[model samples]
Target: MSPQHRLTDLPATARAVIEDRTGPLTSVDMLSAGLNSPIAARLLLDDGTSIFVKGMRTDHRWVWTQQREADINRHTQGLAPRVLWHLTGQGWDLLGFEHIDGVHANYTPGSPHLPLVLQTMSSLAATTAPSSIDLKTMPQRMSAYVDDPRALTAFDGSTLLHTDWKPDNVLITGNRARLVDWGWASRGAAWIDPALWVIWLIASGHTPHQAETQVRAHPAWNTALVPSIDAFTRAQARMWESIARTDTPGQWTHHMHQAALTWAKHRQ
Candidate 1:
């Protein structure tokens, strides 16, 4: 991933955008974590307030994700960081969020944080997708993967899903886990989110069967149709394979594809 921009590096116009909403900035601390975006930092204003800022060049291919994240944050009341403001100017697209002081979740087998992560997923599953926002459906997203068009119907639903389950995207504070990075949020069957997490569990060293057992604690996963699960598993494998082939190949992407294939084989 490219190194993030320092607050001092922001152009005058971009700096003004943040100052217009917040008071004069007193200090800036750039966070060096996360894989997406070229800017991620904490802005400290003169009034002793702090906000998390993330942004990318407006002309970049993933620039639209800034707006998508802002829209999704509006509907994710208790689950995600609150969006304080959004700015698009000075050749950049930026979002400011309530700073969350928490540690990234650990998804390793037998970790105590697993139950809290499951509970958070349950909370997200109960939220209906906001009708006002244009969102992508699971089948629409996986159309390039599935061989049978009929299998697509199994993924159709109105439930909101945070399809990216990387450990860095989940923060555990006290007993609750908070989700961050809404760029990949989608509308799909409730089980889809948990199913995505299963692949992450496998990447974190759990066998496919063991990961399935862990996710079965969710009601959606427990009652999921066998055929629907199989279809999604196969579709996910293809999706990862395509990504691995097209995107810049790396160890992480390669491992993720392997994990998806591992889960698909278990489903068979």
Candidate 2:
């Protein structure tokens, strides 16, 4: 089976470059769906080196974002898949990451192992990194996109911020936890990672009470506790508004709104 993609919109030269990189890609099959960006899957070279390629919106592509992932994985000591290449030319940007090996964590409600996973996350968070990413100016719209304002405000200076620490962003295997997709990484407030983790926990299936309680039990999450629920509420409302405007009319969105309301009610 081969991967399938829709890159007819890319420039001729860019398409050729993509094909050249995947040399003899032969064909493609849908590997994953509903991603925010266009993606393609290419086979691992005879050397056992494979890459996941993605094209990003031109205006939003930045070197800092690409370098951040490279640096984070570099410090991860192989906890993260190696970033094979990153190219930003031809008014288009592409990121090539070594394929990940495990499924994203699935947090079933009341799962006994939830606590252990979070504890492990805190331990991973404690690891100091040699790479220092600059965030003197990250996109101002982050507060608008993320559901936590406190999380964004924590971005006062430079810290190891894996801004998108959702469950889907984490890959766990055989007691080893690896972090991926550092696209939204920032500096300032290491708690940023766990804070994102908290949101993902609740979103995945755990109740707010469960997420809040268990996360706080970890010393790392304590520092990044939601300082202002008021701000978070504002962010949540904005998230719903944005989704309503952008997402296509569909059942998933129906569930999205339902989920938002359910989460909000859980808070009350």
Candidate 3:
């Protein structure tokens, strides 16, 4: 990933484009950078409005993710912050979003945020993928990690999925939770989101059974067949194993790998 760039680091042309829409920028507070974007921040406009902005170089390999996020945001309002503007110029592709105030969700066992997260997931589960926009299917994305390619058939569906369930991607605001980072969104079976949550829940100190019990509240959980869930857990274990191997042996990835393996074992 490219090193994160501060708002002031943007080329004059790029900054001008943003200023054209948002008016003069008074200051910018850099936010956490994601794997796909080098620029993530809250830009304060001269008029006192704050908008979250994230961008990548125009020639970067993951530049497509910026476009995908802008397209997906239209379908994710209430569940995600709205996209306010998109601009590409002076070698940068930037997206400005309606600023949201919230903290990363606490996924620990019995955290009050759990219910809000579940509610957000349930709403996402009911959302239909936009047929008009091309989206990678779950089977297409996960096929390489599974032992039997045929096992991926169980992942087929029309529901839209956030896929990435890291605690940081879920923001708890007041009585509700909102998801961010739609760059990895995909089309998948409704149960897939709940299944994905089980691994994160385990990583956050919930036993496999405890995590399973929590996801059981979502109506889609019943639609998840034993064999399909088994296949998914196994596939995820392999995926995270690959990630941990290729990336630096960071504790977060290591813990996620272990959590995936634990879920796979429990399913077995």
Shift of residue 254 alpha carbon in model 1, Å: 0.6
Candidate 1 residue lDDT tens string, 15-109: 78778778799987877767787778888989898899988878988788889999998788889889988988778788999988999989999
Candidate 2 regions off by >4 Å? 1-30, 56-68, 88-92, 110-120, 127-132, 136-158, 224-230, 249-268
How many residue pairs in model 2 have overlapping backbones? 9
In terms of TM-score, the best-performing candidate is 3
Q: What is the lDDT of residue 219 in candidate 2?
A: 65
Residues 218-239, candidate 2, lDDT per residue (tens digit)? 6655554444333444455456
The lDDT, on a scale of 0 to 1, for candidate 2 is 0.55
Stronger candidate by lDDT (1 vs 2): 1
Per model, how many backbone clashes are there?
A: 0, 9, 0
Clashing pairs in 3: none
TM-score of 3: 0.94
Q: In terms of lDDT, which candidate is stronger, 2 or 3? A: 3
> Which ranges in model 1 have alpha carbons more than 4 Å from their true place?
1-13, 247-250
Weakest 10 consecutive residues, lDDT, candidate 1?
1-10
- Name the candidate, 1 or 2, with the larger TM-score value: 1
